[model samples]
Target: MSDETNNEGLNEAPWRATILTLYPDMFPGPLGTSLAGRALENGLWSLDILHIRDFAEGKHRNVDDTPAGGGAGMVLRPDVVGRAIDAATGEGDMRPRILLSPRGKSLTQEKVRSLKEAGGAILLCGRFEGVDQRVIDGRNLEEISIGDYILSGGELGAMVLMDAVVRLLPGVMGKVASGEDESFESGLLEYPHYTRPTIWEGHEIPEILASGHHGKIAQWRHEQAVALTKERRPDLYEAWEAEE
Candidate 1:
């Protein structure tokens, strides 16, 4: 069940990602484009797609079965998922094992940063009703949810998580500062962005942004970010205020 291949270059222990999912072909889809793609090509990171069904039992290669307590949908078999996890990550692997599920703790920028620091992760893409709870506990997997809503499967969520983490990897993005000023990095949504033409549809870019004063510009951005966060997410604004 290991279709694990490292696109590693010499001496570079790139951030590794081993995704356990039924849809193995869905991997590196968008991640193989843009900054993440370039990083992968540069050997700044590696991807290993572990097809969960590869470890399925029986002639059908069945990975999921009816829900244990009479659910409307089937649940992924713990044994199958367990086998996939084991095959992807061998002994002594220090990477954290994660399961993508709506029931999990909401994923955040802070968590992504932690995973980036870890240099890798083992992501389990749950399908059907969900993976068996017992296996989740036994494997010590960290469950994560992308949002409050549900998706058809966890494949997209895993990709999203990886995309966020990969962009922060050293040398992945054009500028390290890009990640720092982003939304949630400073407990506030990002400030507005403006570009040349300066006047978009008769709306001028903020006057302060055009002032050419670095200190003033920085102050303006901070103020804008604070105001925006307070208006849109008062909870975050409160937390940010508490820290100040």
Candidate 2:
């Protein structure tokens, strides 16, 4: 059975996310708790969980089968996943259909912003070995990976993706500029941040921070962000340099 968890009094045309997965209960888990959760409750966005098993045929209601050509794990059937995709998206839905996979392009801030602007997304979580290649291509699903490592399933990746996108939705964050200087927003890792207790463990907050000069503080932050990115992510640093 499908579960619709949209709150009452929703904003007209709020961002929508429809997740297709065997583990329907996994959704809105973390997405239902923090800033994303608050936004969900305020009707800034909506979530619909579609159980892939609901589309399976046969008395056993099996959705996966032994991988063809011999493999250790079962592969999600194209027919079953296809039916689920079709059910989630009707004619002219226009929202991007995404399949979370390890081999897909790496997820990035730019991609997250694009998704936010796209209005919504339909995420399909692959379990076991993965979904059949035919359905991935046939359904026009764009695969995305959160990192180089692998997870047991795509549910976590889907949540990660949703969290990144939801926080960018207008009115979700306390301040619009709050996201402006974050890591990757400017193609660099964010600079270090400090709070209360100016002097801690014999180490005082950087003098430049307390100088009361906004211009110098901005300069210091940018330099720190550049140095940090260059040291840890030379690839990003080079790309950022090239763009400049």
For candidate 2, write residues 129-190 as lDDT tens digits. Answer: 99999999999999999999989999999999999999888767766666898899999999
Residue range 1-244, candidate 1, lDDT tens digits: 1122333332657999999988989989999988788888888889999888889878798888898668598988889988888898887998999999999999999999999999899999989788899899989999999999999999999999999998877666665577789899999999999889988788898899888999999999999999999999999999999999
- Flag regions of model 1 displaced more than 4 Å: 1-12
In terms of lDDT, model 2 sits at: 0.92
User: Candidate 2, which segments miss by more than 4 Å at Cα?
Assistant: 1-12
